[model samples]
Target chain A: MQTSTHANPRALRDIEMALERTKAEIPVLTPMVTAFGPLLAERFRLREAASGWVGPLPVVDAERFSQGVFVLADSGFQDMSAHLSEAAHGLLPIMANSFPAMAQELNTLIAAMDNGALTMDALAAAGFGEAFTVPGVNAETMDFAVAELVRPFVERQAQDLAKLVRDLPWRQTICPICGGTPNMSVLRRIRNDSEFIQAHGGRRFLRCSCCATEWTHKRISCPSCGCEEPDELVVLSDPSRPFERADACHRCKTFLLCLDTGELADIPDPDVAALTMLPLAHQARRQGFVPLAEHPWGGL
Target chain B: MPKAIFIDTTRCTACRGCQVACKEWKNFPAVPTKQRGTHQNPPDLTHYNFKLVRFSEHLEGDVVQWYFFPDQCRHCLEPPCKEASTVDGAIIRDDATGAVIYTEKSSKEDLETVRSACPYNIPRQDPVTKRLVKCDMCIDRVRANLLPMCVKSCAMGAMNFGNREDMLKLAGERLEAVKKEFPKASLLNQDDVSVIYLVADLPAKYHEFAVAGVSGSMTRKQMLARIFAPVRKIGQQVRG
Candidate 1:
């Protein structure tokens, strides 16, 4: 059995600490924290393991590139599917023992995904269409849960493709590996040899919500509409909290939440930071603007 | 990055979408109004309306050209109101977004002093709440990854927002394009305020305070006060 070490142990610890802090700060989120926290930690472990299994992926043609262009073309998909199925099986207790055959179904889904046979239409045809539906849960909520469960396996394939085409000239707003809209934007400070200290300058990276692929994008443009007109974009930030802000575009009526990691004492998991900004999401919705991607926390 | 909004006055159709959207988003109660002989209803920015689309008319050769100016707080880079306010938290500038915010504590401050300090005559006081109010740049929405309601509701592409550098660049580009047709096209107070207005005509053809330097003459004492305001606040903090 290959031991899973997808995320670095220290990073995993940090994520746990962030979850704990988030739980402490928002008591209402305790139930959710208790439910998904362990799963996320496990996912991190899977991601760490996946990081080590990097292999050559087929080059994506720049001309006809789309987010779904890269499909799993290696035998590693089998190992990834097996590992993820085991992970999904571990969740049976928390899932109230529902979806008893989830592991077998997940394996089937993984194989189908690897072979480009796992589209929504295909899933519907295979009678797994309602697999995500739970009695009281909204479709979006259920979809989020399902995505979380399968993310580790999907991330493995995405990581390999991301590495293979890291230097490709990808200009699309969607992720080159998964074709998914970015869930979070992170700003990291740039350090040069002349400046021993970190410079105020930074680059913006868009992280895919589905497969965890990250790509660099223009700092001032809207990721949704590709609005390079600076006049059509706005940065909204809470006066009380200066570290996080929403980059909203007037043209597309879309916004993307961004976190400045350089301002923090310790780097936080982008996912955790995004979750904590649920109040901001509410504020955005009230103003009639939507996010670039349909985020799990967006329903809140 | 510090953020800004660019208003292209040439594109404003005076639909009042921005004005209505600002009120709707802020949830400010409507103030009674009568038609003021022109399409510019309510006439001026009131306590209920943080944003007002001002209308003015001028004769260009033979045709009567109507100008629309959506008036709101400029959210000055170095806000004079912030400098003039003695009350703690009465006025604050968000370092992250460059939004000049008037807090609830502003109710306790001398409203006239804060009002007089503005170069653009933007601030208004709510008679009931006593809180000084202005366009907050929709800081709440902006922080939440949403465009300001005014910007969102504007279908004409007149109002826009983004980082200060990008907005400035856009203003320059738009000004160049607009000047090709309207020789007098210019950007209003681009260097000193978060809201940059790209007007297609002379500044006077718009509202009186459409450009800075048209209002609120600064005394030497006020200038000194503006310069030393930060030091004085810090000194007060130390003393306290």
Candidate 2:
């Protein structure tokens, strides 16, 4: 069933308000996306595919085919709020229940923002991700950009992503619903607001693009070829986002980005947090392996 | 089991998630595009873009209805494009995924014949490689046990993929559900291809050749050649 709960007028209003706020926040977050350009570039393959967009590039013999796919994946949009909301929903209620006063305080902060006292900058200062600042971006854009940015990073976290993919529970020929691929491979680890035990809390597994099903993909396997050769497959990482890496298999010659939340102090929006690793993607592409997709914020 | 993708136009929000996902999964590139007074970016499919969501608006009674057809090579059971190719591995259907794959061999094939033989006007020639290209249904990914990229990326659930039996079932269910709302709703070319469409109106109302017959049949010689074409391949191999 289509989830009408979020499509109703009130929800639409909330989403619209959220989008407008998110767009406004773009000017503010531009600095962050710009700051981590190399990591993002490396992971996302930020380069021109062709002189023209609609037609073939000057290169031939399917070489451009690889580059083209790389470019699209890099720039693909991801729905940010949905995942953020999903993550936040789990974390929020606990705060509301355990520390009712802090929860009340958080509500007041949001209320102040609703009343225009808390600027997007202020929200960022308070550790809220940029997604809460913008408005108008539907779930699709967030989903695309987020997936584009994070998928490779997540894939890279596991040594042999292909093997990891082979073990995933939702491993099917097509997505159960939309027939898309795995956007973010998650390990079902949920963290409550209490101690904020940043690591090893949320679900653990790979997330599918079609149905967003998060299933267990082994930690050290190629997500594409399922090849078990660690020597044939290598993992590349960025110093900035030490938790993330680009896993490339020499055997299949395909690469997936990976993020190790076990290393982060906060729940990284696989999409937004991945901006720190784009340049690594570019470096990987220069080495000849193609990323699954382009990171969405590459050009922006 | 052979897999198929069921596209329900009625459910499409024209978000182009499938379009982007198809490119992403296939590892195809971004086609440079402009605002052509329509959201249909990059206009039509090309060598790099295997799947394209075509949008057309028409007046139905007093309402202006916008129709979207996420277009791609149909991967016909007997793909005319495959029959048109004289080169080996140029356009071979993977028996596993039933995916009509256009390999590098296409660069050597007679491009005009292959392009013209396509009933859906699909297939574009790459200027540089001189190879023909279209959707391969992400066979590599399918082989890796994942959904087709386009199917995976669709956010609106307009696109679906599964075994032929399941896709047909879903297509039938969608058709029946859609028919109650739109009496003319039906599935297009469900029998001949892996990509089946659940359209909410007369197929033609969506596109001139939205229906299977619109592309017309293969020429008499092409038809005959297609039948004998397989034998020709074996003969050439045996002779060599």
Q: Which candidate leads in lDDT?
A: 1
Lowest summed lDDT window (length 10), candidate 2 chain A: A1-10
Task: Mark the 10 consecutive residues where model 2 chain B has the least summed lDDT.
Answer: B213-222
Q: What is the lDDT of residue A159 in candidate 1?
A: 62
For every candidate structure, what is the RMSD over all alpha carbons to the true structure, in angstroms?
15.4, 24.0
Candidate 2 deviant stretches above 4 angstroms: A1-300, B214-240
Tell me the tens digit of each residue's lDDT in model 1 across A10-61: 6887788778877876677776666556666776765666543434556556
A-chain TM-score, model 1: 0.73
Candidate 1 runs further than 4 Å off: A1-300, B214-240
Q: What is the Cα-based lDDT of residue B32 in candidate 2? A: 75
TM-score of chain A of each: 0.73, 0.40
Tens-place lDDT per residue, model 2, A1-300, is 010001122323333332333234344544444433323333322111111122232222234322222112233222222222232333333333443434554444434545666453433322312444324333333333333333332323221222223322343322222234554443333322232212333334554442233445566677777887869989787564455677888988877666665422223344543444556666777898875544444333
Error of 1 at A290 (Å): 23
Location of the lowest summed lDDT over 10 successive residues in candidate 1 chain A: A190-199
For each candidate, what is chain B's TM-score?
0.90, 0.88
lDDT of 1 at A216: 75
